[model samples]
Target chain A: MSVRQTATAVRGRYQPRISLWWWLTKPSYLLFVLRELSSVFIAWFIVFLLLFVRAVYQGEGQYERFLDFAANPFVVFVNLVALAFVLLHTVTWFVLTPQALPLHLRGRRVPGGLIIASQYVGWLVVSAFVFWLVVGW
Target chain B: MRRRRPVEPLVWLLFSGGGVVTAILVPVLLVLLGLAFPLGWIDPPPYEHIHAVLGHWIARIVLLGLCVLGFVHWAHRFRYTLHEGLKLQRLDAQISLLCYGLALIGSVWAVYILLFTG
Candidate 1:
């Protein structure tokens, strides 16, 4: 191998050291970080739902106990925070969806705003359906 | 020659599917079940109602989709978060294993609970 080729191969790209709290530097960065962090809470919500379902499966007594647990101040606080993060996740997910799944009609691409607005419409419809199933129905 | 298909697009499909499902369903569920029902802001549904709803095949399928896709979504995002946000790419293999491993376990647990328990 040529000496220049050997030198180039030996020296890799320079990567600047980044701090762990780099996301804190700007509002947008923080928002991005929070959106990423929302995944953890999403996982938490799944676990919460599983436990609730299991409690329901076990019967009335267990279900009541689960409700009591959920009603605890700490659990309620955690859930409130989780709700915030998940809301952020929903907003960011929908906004970004336009980029990931661009829709086309005829020959032209669909407007991003239209896609995002449709997502909100879908969210409302889905939420209403769930409300009907869980409470209204 | 037949080219080998990459697993990434499938993973991203699960991720996006999960994102859309959870985005639409979770917030209201959280408000109703997590907050309102527990706090008595709204009357809790009858245990029979909840039980009956969950017992239905459709509810089971929706829930299974939610849990399975949700975890896959979480796995993909959290994996990228560690790699990019925290700059932990050096531990890529281990990180991928840990994130996706937990997702797998969570999905299995959801399946078991959905199938066997309730």
Candidate 2:
């Protein structure tokens, strides 16, 4: 029960647990966990998408109802969650992307950092274009 | 220690590339369609015109390839990270199989949507 002994014991018995407290307090940890929670957003989006499909099969009134359901504050909160999910998803996805997409053009070792940065840059350009269109056009 | 072939790493690369490309291409195309379609600044040419941008054969192949690869990437990375990083266990294989399985099914579904629907 001494401190070192306790540390050893905890490490020895580590049981597939990440600290809930740590996850709560740690910004990146919470972000990563929140990214995982993004499945909720995915599910909500899909359910509504399914509703749209159903409405298409049904008629305009059902589609309007679908729109109505979509406009609720709860739905807006859900979208906000989805946006946060996407942010975490994108950043983490790119950061880890190094492990996934190790492409090389001339037998050079492509740095993961470069890959991730490029991906984000590409996203930024595309997003800027979208913003430009949304605002200007 | 034996240096095992880095199969997982290579697979990760494919996953990353596909994910990145799709991640970039999709939103841009969508936005362009949204803005340009309405204002006549950016128009998606006729399906016939646009379809050939990615040749018929290439488009289908790439789409299926991307869908399958991206999901597999998600599966392998997520499972391994959960197991090693967060120290989660007991469900690694289950999660991996489930995610990858969805990817496979999704690939087939996408193929059907593209080829048969069109």
Q: What is the interface RMSD of candidate 1, in Å?
A: 4.1
lDDT of 1 by residue, B1-118 (tens): 1123598789989999999888888899899878998888998888999999988989988999999999999999999999879777567789989999999999999999998886
Report the lDDT tens digits of candidate 1 across residue range A16-92. 45678989999999999899999998999999999999999999999899999999988888889999999999999
Estimate, for each residue in B1-118, the C-alpha lDDT of model 2 and write its tens digit.
1134567677667666644654554344333432334334553344334334333665556545645554555555555556544654446557667766765665565555444543
Native interface contact recovery, all models? 0.82, 0.04
- Residue pairs clashing in model 1 are none
- Chain B alone vs. reference chain B, TM-score for every model: 0.93, 0.56
After superposition, which runs of candidate 1 have C-alpha atoms over 4 Å from their true positions?
A1-13, B1-5
Clashing pairs in 2: A100-B12, A100-B13, A101-B12, A101-B13, A102-B13
Can you write out model 2's per-residue Cα lDDT over A56-81, one digit (the tens) per residue?
33445654565456557676565655
**Chain A vs native chain A, TM-score per candidate:** 0.88, 0.64
Model 1 TM-score is: 0.92
lDDT of 2 at A68: 56
